[model samples]
Target: MSAETIVKKCVFVEAINLICILMAKCSRLCRGNIYSLLKMSKGSSSRERG
Candidate 1:
């Protein structure tokens, strides 16, 4: 089929795939942020230069 004649279901599937990709990235980013905060709050602010 020509690009212009694609059906609506295919378009909807593409949209869902795009959203899933974005959501996965967002989830990873949030996890990283939470991990950093957790590490920081656990009292390892800085290592002494002994």
Candidate 2:
């Protein structure tokens, strides 16, 4: 293999790793928001029923 090809492969791998990291962070954030929303809804419903 050539040095150029090796560099390209390294870059591609780095890009994929960066994308995966970003996706993981975004999913965690979304999950937290959804969890909080669910908790709020439950609390409101319970208050109404009581």
Candidate 3:
């Protein structure tokens, strides 16, 4: 793919990483998915802000 697509994918993966980190200490299964969703939203918004 192109650089832009790569960057976007990186953002997504970064968000996933952050979510995983946040859920690392939590035992609830739902928290991990919720954090992933939150991270996706945050990543998109942060790109706009940037």
Q: lDDT values of the candidates?
A: 0.84, 0.99, 0.90
For model 1, residues 5-50, the per-residue Cα lDDT tens digits are 6767688889999999999999999999999998886656454322
Winner on TM-score (1 vs 2): 2
Tens-place lDDT per residue, model 3, 12-46, is 99999999887775747678879998999999999
Report lDDT (Cα) of residue 18, candidate 3: 90
Question: Between prediction 2 and prediction 3, which has the larger lDDT?
Answer: 2
lDDT digits (tens) for residues 1-50 of candidate 2: 99999999999999999999999999999999999999999999999999
lDDT of model number 3: 0.90
Please give the clash total of every predicted structure, in order. 0, 0, 0
- Which residue pairs does candidate 2 place in steric collision? none
Could you tell me the TM-score of candidate 2? 0.67
If ranked by lDDT, best first, what sequence of candidates would result?
2, 3, 1
Q: What's the lDDT for residue 42 in model 2?
A: 99
Better of 1 and 3 by TM-score: 1
